[model samples]
Every structure is written in structure tokens, then in C-alpha cells.
Target: MLHSLDADLAVIDPEYQLRRAARVDNELIYLTRTGGGGARFARRIRRAREEVRTVCGVCGRPGIPRTRSRTVLCDLHWHPLTAVEKAFALSADIPEAWFTDEAEIKNDAYVARSAADQRKESANHLSERDMADLLGVTVQRVHEMFEQELLAGANHDGRVVYPRWQVMEGGRLLPHLPVVLRAADGIEARTLQAIMENVDEDLEGATPAQWLAHGGCVEPVLQTLDQWWWI
Candidate 1:
């Protein structure tokens, strides 16, 4: 059994508690994230949009639309922002073009992939609870890794699942996964797997995962990702 302090940690972790609550009450999750209630949420959103239009959400640097970013984030703050809101949060001045969440990612010069077959890729999968155990980390860390896209996973049925291949001996993630995962933020796991496994022209021969496994630099992969248009 965990020590008393360890036992108390899960209840205290907002992500763990939120996960538990989400299993029971999705509406509660939505309400909590939106800051509660319909009218108040709308007001909060309106106020947020207004603030972002004038200043950089990251630094408060002031600039106008198009003069800064075609989107809400200013040019300096605009390096490879993903739709993962926690990873990149800004309420206002988000590009009208980029609205509907990373649709603009498609419209931008970025990586592109072909249609992925959505078969159930659930073999050797680990649950959130199981992965935490495997990594010997706190549940919160597991959530952070997944949310930050340092871990690759996909939704299977209604639940999220991570493939066993990403975890190596001693529970370490594959080399350079964090950097690669950052580029693949919105990609489906199968598509990402395909991209990583295939021998590509970019590397001049080796697959991306193989490239990294053999100690290749990550810059070339990032360049491909920079202009990646998601399929």
C-alpha cells in the first residue's frame, strides 16, 4: 500500500479527480472547463476574444490582425502552435481562418498524410491507469505527458489507449518521442505510425522512427512538420 501521503495525492490531483469525475459526469467536466453556466460562459468567451485581438496573449505585445499573425497569436509567439489548448492557450485574436480548431492547420503550409484506415488499433494498448503503473509515475504526470503530446495514443471506442511500441524496456518512451510527438499533435496514431515507419525521401532513405533510433537529428523532421497539412 502507498504511504498516507501517497494515498492522499490522487484525490488532491486536479487531473486525477477530473478523470474520475469525467467517467461519471461529462456535463460536469464541460461546465468546469467552460467556467460554469451558459450566460456566464458566453460572457467570458466574448471578453476573451476582445482581449486577444489587441495584445499577444503570451507577452502582451500589442499588434493588429494580419500585421501580427493571420491568427490571434502574434508572429513571435506563433511558432508551431497546436490546437491542444493547454499546450497553447489564447482566448482572443485567434485567426478567424484558423477557427474550428486546426482547420487552419490544414489551410496552412504543413505536413500532409493520406486517408488512414480507422481499424481498431487497440492491440497491446495500455489504459491511463495501466500506463501510470508502467511508467512508475504519478497519475498526474501521465496525464501531462499525454496532454502535452509527449506520449502517442488514440481514442479506442470512447476511451484513450496508448500502444506498447512507444514504451521500451524499463518503461522509457522511444527516443525523441517528445520532439516527434510535438509535430504530430493532431495526427491520428495510425497515420503517425505509418509516417514514422515508412522510408521517406526527406531522410534520403530511413523511416522517421528509424532515423531517430539511429541518432539522426530532429531538425529535418520538424521542418517537414512545419509545413505539414493534416489530412
Candidate 2:
């Protein structure tokens, strides 16, 4: 699908690599990528424009469409930000021509949103409660792991404070979140601790490679738990 943009010169291939080029005309510009159903895709997207009265980007709420250039985000869930606001947040300057077209605007929005998500993720240091939620276990289990040296955490205000890295590291120890061990309702806190301790003990004699082998299931397990609404 991407080849079409290059064929049309809609993308610049400065290095002779088939890259989609940005197109500008009059007061409008667009970022084009090849995606369509023959000649039918454009028709469908156009029909969507007419038929889709409103789409809220954040909470998925329905609302009236406002055609202002920067007003693309669903008003209910997202605060519309000016291009300057985006530039400041991303620490990058955006070209003025890019804002002239709806498609380019959408692409810029995507890039800005991704940067925001990355910033949030980097700052999200998990607490004990966060780890408990991630593991589908109890706060007590985190404490137990600490006591057994299978997990490392700090004591803050007499409460166990777990950093996000610790949870990710612990996920390395047990790839899957403890959904099965959690039972239909939930596993007792002590039971969770004992299970982790046992798992850690079993791998004590194993190599780092063996540790990594078991760790690959973490993402899949997270997916399964999310599917089950266990996470």
C-alpha cells in the first residue's frame, strides 16, 4: 500500500528510498500513506465523514464536529492544545505548513500523544498497591517478597513502597501475572508470598538464561489477564 505514495511523488525519496512525501497545495497540506480498498477506500472514508456526526477521541463520546484546524480531538475527553503547547511539550518545533491540512494535523496529534504517553510511562513508579494490582495479588504479598528477598522495596510511612522497576524486575522472575494463583476470587496474601518464594527457590540453582526463559510469558499473561478483566 505504501508504494502508491512514492509512485505519485506524494512522498519525498531524497535517499531514493520509497518514503511517503508530504503534499501541500494552496492553504492545505496532507501527510499521505497508501491505504485504500482499490478506489473504494477514499469513498468509504468520505462517507464516514458525512455519516459519522461525531467521534470523541478520548472517552469515545459522541459530539458535534467543529471544523477549526486544531479542534480535532474529541472535546469531552481531551483538552484542545495549540500547536505552541504541543511544541513546548515535545521540545520540538513544528512547521507552520503542517497545520494547514486535516491529515497532517492528525499525524502531528498522534506524534504528540505518543510523546505524552511515553513521558507518563517513564514517570509511573509503582507503589505497593500498584504492584499488587499488576500481580493481581495483595499488598501483603509484596511485603512477603521483600522479607524473602525475592522482591526489593522500601518502607515509607510504615507501608511498603514498591518502585515500578521492581515490579518489572519481579515480572522477570515470574513471567505471568498471578491470575491462576489468584483463584476465581483471589488468593490469600500469604499464599501469594509462598508461591513466589517457591518459584524463586526453584530457580536459585538455574542460570540467568534460564531465568530469562521463564520471563517471556509476562506480556502474554498480562494480555490474558486484561482479556479476563483480571488486570
Candidate 3:
């Protein structure tokens, strides 16, 4: 026998055992009771596991439970040392265990290395193409970044739109950068394409989000303004 779905588009069997469920907006208004809640619970657990699989930004690996604490370290790159470990490290007699777990030393090195890289990258001036190249997303996507108001920009009608200086000034609230950069530079399509190529030369392959996150160009723009407050 065939069964018809409701106007709400909820599917269910003859017994209404919740075979399906749906949500509108934030509300779960439709539920089909075909089998049982066990199936739903199982699905929920699967989703939870998938969510946990996300990698931590600091460590570049899947998040995992750590021996130092009960809290899972799947996404936490900097695992705070326990009081015992802290005291041991600070003590005149350092524990040999601290040296044995090369992982702890590795974390410190990661932080130092990342900081140095950031400093070096921040010193460089970004051309239009340099900005475009690293962000693997298209020029249109770059424009969307501006539309989203992530970055402030100044109009250069006859010229290129440039990002506003405020984006990186005094380490202030960094708005979404595209809007600001586009406005400041009044950039054209070709200039953006050039940027993409320049970035590819250095990064090999990079995503738009990665380019934005690197945040070197923004800081330099702000620093340049320090000389001329007349604007």
C-alpha cells in the first residue's frame, strides 16, 4: 500500500512511528514517528562524533584527549599545565618527565615559530595581485568580502579602492577586511588577478580565508598611516 505525505511534507508510516523529522527556522515543528527514538539518538551521536573530529588550529592535528586533564584537547592547541607540573617546572629541581614528553617543548616551539613567521610577513608591502593570489577564492569572492563589510575601504573612483587604515591600527577591532581593502584601493579585476598570482608564487596554494587570516597587509597599511595623520 502507498502512503501520502502531509502538506507539511512530513513522511511517516501507517503507525506514525516518526520515520522522519524536519525543522523550520530554529523550531523542530515536524516529527515522523515510524520506528523509534533510538534511531534518532544514534544519528545524533554520529553527528556529535563528526563535530569532534575537527582539527585544532594550533597543533594541526585532530583534537584528542590529553593525559594532563580530563578535558578533551581535540581543538585546544595550548594545553595549560596543571598546578603540579607548573610548580615542578618552576622548582629548582626540574622533573625529567618534562624533558621526556617532547610534545610540551614542541608546543612552545610552535608558538615561537608562528610569531616569527607573522612578523616577517607583516614587514612586506602587498600589491593588488599579492592580495588576490593568496586568497584562492575568485575576485568576485573578494568583492563579497567587501560587501559583507568585513573590511573598510576608501573610494578611489579614478583609481583603485584601498583598505582603510583602521583595520590594523593599534591592533583595534579588525573588521572583515575585504570591504575596507576594496574601498581603500578602488581595485580593478586585473589587479586582483595579479594579486592571486603573486600569492601563489609564495604560498604554492592558499585559500581566500587563509589569505585573510594571515593578516599581514592590514597591519602594514595601518603602520604606514602613522607618518601622515593629516588624512
* Top candidate when judged by lDDT against the true structure: 1
Candidate 1 is scored at a TM of 0.42
| Ordered list by TM-score, greatest first | 1, 3, 2
- 1-231 in candidate 3: lDDT tens per residue? 012223212232233333223221111222232333345433543443343334332343465434221122333345566778667665856444543457566666755554554443333333234334544556566456556655333233233342323223333434444443454353333233223222231233542223444563544333222211110
In order of lDDT, best first, we have: 1, 2, 3
Cα error, candidate 1, residue 110 (Å): 34
Ten residues in sequence with the least summed lDDT for candidate 1 = 22-31
The TM-score, computed over Cα atoms with residue i paired to residue i, of candidate 2 is: 0.22
lDDT of 2 by residue, 1-231 (tens): 124423433223222222112111101111222322234433433334432335433223464433322223354225445767756644654344433466455645754664564445334445777777778778889768756555545443356654343344445433333332333234223222222222232245432223435464343323222222110
Clashes of each: 11, 4, 42
The local distance difference test score of each candidate is 0.52, 0.39, 0.37
Q: Tell me how far the alpha carbon of residue 15 in candidate 1 is from the true structure, in angstroms, after superposition.
A: 46
lDDT of 2 at 73: 38
What lDDT does candidate 3 reach at residue 90?
55
Q: Is candidate 2 or candidate 3 better by TM-score?
A: 3
**Model 2: runs farther than 4 Å from truth?**
1-124, 169-231
Tens digits of per-residue lDDT for model 1 on 46-163? 4434444565433446644432112333553455555676234455655444444454455242211111111223445688888999999887888788887888877665777887
Candidate 3 scores a C-alpha RMSD against the true structure in Å of 19.7
